[model samples]
Target: MLTPSVEALIQHLADGKFHSGKKLADTLQTSRTTVWKSVQSLQALGLEIQAVKGRGYRLTHPWERLNAEQITASIQVPEACPPPVVEVHDCLNSTNAHLLRTASLRPAASICLAEMQTAGRGRLGRNWVSPFGANIYLSLLWRFRRGESLGGLSLAVGVETVRVLRTLGLADLRLKWPNDILWQERKLGGILIEAITESQGQCVVVVGLGLNLRLPPGAADAIDQPWVDIRTILGGGSSRSDLAVPSRNRMAGDLSSRLLALLNAYGSEGLTPWLEDWRRWNCVLGRRVTVDEIGQRYEATAVNVTEEGSLVLRRDDGRRRLLAAGDVRLRVRHDA
Candidate 1:
């Protein structure tokens, strides 16, 4: 229930104009004192409202906030996700590190989102370039008990991420071997799932996801391979800085919901339901590939992924090898 003066201030901020106190008061048919009080309240709510003596208040920068209230309001739930105890941070070293530090105190379903990640990371200790203003940089914390092998957790998350992406109309999104998501031949996004298991019998997995929303300027130089962004998937009339996607908010809500459903489904139904979906979107199958684990390299023809989540392949000598875990690199085929 904003007063007329408060509404006027909001409009002025959105319009990016410098309105004096007298001008704001006249626009709202209110006194200058009321206008000043209203501006004070917005500043209290994490807004960088810069005040000037001659001019009036102005926002320091454009808004890129992902508030829970906004996200929850944007979604219509089929079955409500376990309402994630959401934590919003202006900056962090890495959401994964934050989650791991507070793991014991954290509730079962909690999500940590950072507007800027100072030290975000990726699989095999790769540096994830998480710029301040562009990307859905977050980590989700979920727990499992003793004796649950941590192997297929990344695959499970990959399935869930694809489900979310499919809802956004990217139906042809494919999974590249381990956890990279690809559209056509370019990389879309990647997932990293790291776990901590105690000797007694408890496990906690921090699932970290880095999705390219809008590529920041000069960001492509850092990436060594083919990459894609949301702007690339959609057309190119708009500027990279413009946050005009109507469904962006909805996608966030959908991601949270589907992730919870997948977590619950995995606990109850196991990974049986997701096997076929993975096969349909699998990028490594039928490709010439090399599996590099530790310092050893094994070259094989990508044949299939087993029901137990191991990769099954036939070598050049017409022999089969089952790879339990490794970095799979796809080689170019002359036939293509």
Candidate 2:
């Protein structure tokens, strides 16, 4: 396997410019043949590399290589879940599918991460692109205590996501109701939690996360809402561009460890302790929005997110309605 530095070098050279193999060898302090092998290794990872007579090699586009080992080293147990165990895949139909099949057989705290998901999905059965080397696609298996249902686990997850982004120095990040993370007003990421109830009413929750580290051409068109990628928020530039794109491995490691820790803390404190954090990063609150539940739509001024995570909205009729479970969509008029 190519070391992280070599992998970073591959991405750095992915820019359109022609980079000589000898130059790459010199930069990476490796033999020319070694550089050639590294290039071949990247090709297997789904990157398109071109080798011309004069031009050494160039990537057709950028790709992110997530680090699994780094993530494994960062797990800290704060909840009653199992010890962290990760399974990294080159491709899969869905991380959640894998978790669903293994939940009964496997212990909790098992994680599945894929380089690409052929059939990733979000709430409401929306298609999520799992492009090779584009972003973070992961599913974590957790078993909570029987009959222990936190009122606002989704909202708490959203708040924690913003905290993770802030830990990376990502600013202007906010949370939409339910479990969506936004950069300014553009959708940045989403969370989906699927719970399986056993015969005895025991529950196993599979939390799936999809984050756009980098967006490829045409992928953005599939998303109906306004969205942004990490590259866009950091500034439109290639990994080889002046700023360094953090290692996907480091990102995986840091995010997973921190997420597990948050879950542990949430297990004890519930959502109340994070109310202020959620409020600070709220994006849809106080906005005129449409809350959709069970095919019925209600338009109201986004008033607040209660301690229980239900959206508290003030309708035009001067009534306060607490939406239990619904699709909260920002009204077109509010954005206009």
Q: Could you tell me the lDDT of residue 119 within candidate 1? A: 83
lDDT for model 2, on a 0 to 1 scale?
0.74
True-vs-predicted CA distance for residue 293, candidate 2, Å: 2.8
Residue-pair clash count for candidate 1? 0
* Residues 37-148, model 2: lDDT tens digits: 8778766555567898777888765444555666787665555545888888877889998899778787767888998787899876788877777788878877776767
Residue-level lDDT for 303 in candidate 2: 80
Worst 10 residues of 1 by lDDT: 240-249
Model 2 CA lDDT for position 302: 76
lDDT score, candidate 1, position 223: 78
Off by over 4 Å in 1: 1-63, 72-83, 198-200, 236-248, 326-336
Candidate 1, after superposition: displacement of residue 224 in Å?
Answer: 1.7
Best model number under lDDT: 2
Backbone clash pairs for candidate 1 read none
